[model samples]
Target: MFRRTFWFTTGVATGVWATTKVNRKLKQLTPENLAVAAANKAIEAGGRLRDRAVDFALEVRDNMARREAELGDALGLNAPVDRALPPPRGYAVIENRNSPKYVEGPGQKSTYTTYPYNRNEDH
Candidate 1:
């Protein structure tokens, strides 16, 4: 009789342990639970991407301002125009036209070519 009771107790404990483990595993594998986890992961990834894009944009703006200042200095302009220029007041005009024709002076060789070159080439 004692042996029967011991076996019964052991079986109940084993069943309870198995049930808890299966429940835990099922919760982990459920589609709704996985979807929520995936959404959280996507949100984290998007936040990182946004931060990188902002950093890249700021870097590009800074470089453009530096280059504009350098060009103004080389041209002997009295005041730096970029620093003084305000943001466009109205809808921005898109000037998509090609560059103006190069005019050569007397006794100057025509070195103009249609191929693109860096802006510093003129300096």
Candidate 2:
């Protein structure tokens, strides 16, 4: 009667819903779907790694340039060289390699260590 028809319809709907859910799960488990998912994830990871590597290289280059300039200034390497003569007025090298090497004239009094000490020291 009416109750029987209602139960029959309910059972059919439930069966159809279960079938659709199982078919969707099976599609996800298939080799093609899994491979596509893995490939997408790998591509995403590679892109992230590449970006990080590029950032690190750029940082290293910047710091290296900065350090090179600092060294050039310390060692007097940035100064223009005059190949002709040993001029009376110029930069002088101190005993310490870490110190700044510059002087305007022989008459100037400065903290730089020079010739007097080298003459006094026993070689």
Candidate 3:
């Protein structure tokens, strides 16, 4: 009797353990879990691609600026290089009151008044 009871209990325990493991594995392999994992990997890849693109763009801009300076020196242009940032249209205080002010009508819920001042042409 003792031997039979022990064997029966061992069998029940083994069956329960196997069932729990199989259920857990099936849940992990479901379509919803797989899709979510794939989406996360895709998002990570996209972010990496964007960062690489931005870095490439910045490097290209720097190289172009350097090449332009070298060409200017070789050509012997005596004009002083100006790197000052121009003030934005709204923030710039126009000295000449007669300077032309171009009005842009409301388009797409945005209304803007722009001053058409040419930097090359001094007022």
Q: Summarize candidate 2's per-residue lDDT along 1-123 as a digit string, tens digits.
A: 999999999999999999999999999999999999999999999999999999999999999999999999999998988889776887664364444443445676545545543443432
Model 2 worst lDDT run, 10 consecutive residues: 96-105
Report the lDDT tens digits of candidate 1 across residue range 52-76: 9999999999999999889988888
User: For model 2, what is the error of residue 69's alpha carbon versus the real structure, in angstroms, after optimal superposition?
Assistant: 1.3
Please name the candidate that would achieve the greatest lDDT relative to the true structure. 2
**Residue 43 in model 1: lDDT:** 100
Q: Which stretches of candidate 2 lie over 4 Å from their true place?
A: 1-15, 80-123
Steric clash count of candidate 3: 0
Model 1, residue 52: C-alpha shift (Å)? 0.5
Q: Could you tell me every candidate's TM-score relative to the true structure?
A: 0.48, 0.53, 0.47
Between candidates 1 and 2, name the one with more favorable TM-score: 2
* Pairs clashing within candidate 2: none
In the range 6-91, model 3's lDDT, one tens digit per residue, is: 99999999999999999999998999998998999999999999999999999999999999988988897746878999887775
When summed lDDT is taken over every stretch of 10 residues in candidate 1, the lowest stretch is 94-103
Model 3 clashing residue pairs (backbone) = none
Clashing pairs in 1: none
What lDDT does model 1 reach? 0.80
